[model samples]
Target: MVDRLEQSKALASDVRLTILTWLKTPALHFPHQVTGDPAEIGVCVTLLADTLRISQPTVSRHLEVLRRAGFLRVRRIGRWSFFARDEITLSDYAEWLRDTL
Candidate 1:
C-alpha cells in the first residue's frame, strides 16, 4: 500500500535511521533537556538537534515526518517539544525487520 511504502521511504533515509539509534541512547544522543527529561520520559527537540549536529528546524522537520507516520510520540512542556519512541510500533518495526532479514 501507499502508506506502507511512504513510511518505508521515510525510514529508508540514513538520517532518520540515525535518529532512531540516537533515541536509544539517552546520555550521548541528546543534550540536557530539563523540561521533558529523557531519563524520566523522553528526549526533547532542542536536545535532539544539538546531539545530531543539525539545526533545530531541520531536526524538527524530520521528527514531524516520523511522528506523522506513527513512528513517534511527542510531548510538550511550555515551549519545549519532546519526543519518544512509540514502543508498540517500534517493536513491530523490529519484528518486521527480523522477519525480512
Candidate 2:
C-alpha cells in the first residue's frame, strides 16, 4: 500500500496543489503549444513554468513531487515532458482517504 504520510506531504505544498488545479483545465490555464496536443499529450513543462511565473527547474521540482505521489502522470515525447493528472490514482487516493479518516 502507498504511504499515507507521503501522500499528505505531496499535497501539503501550495505550489503542488496549484499545479494539480491548473492541470484540471489545462486548456483554460495554459497556452497552446507549437507542436504537441495539449488535450492528448498533456501540458508542457515550459508552458507550466511560464503560467506559474516560476523557473522551469522550480516547476519541474514541484511536478516531480506530484509524480512521485501518483497524483500526476508524465509522458516523455521527444525532448519535452508533458504532465497530466492521473485520474485513477486520484480516485484511489480519495477512496483511501475516506476509509483512513
Candidate with best lDDT:
2
Per-residue lDDT, model 1, residue 10, is 70
1-101 per-residue lDDT for model 2 (tens digits): 88777878999989999999888888777757765667777899999899889999999999999999999999998998999999898889989899988
Give the distance in Å from residue 15's predicted Cα in candidate 1 to where it truly belongs.
Answer: 1.6
Every model: Cα RMSD to truth: 2.4, 1.2
- TM-score, structure 2 vs. true: 0.92
What are the TM-scores, per candidate, against the unseen true structure? 0.80, 0.92
Residue 73: error of model 2 in Å?
0.9
Model 1 TM-score, all chains together: 0.80
Candidate 1 lDDT tens digits, 1-101: 22555567679777788887877776565556656458557788877788788999999999988887778888777777778878787787667768977
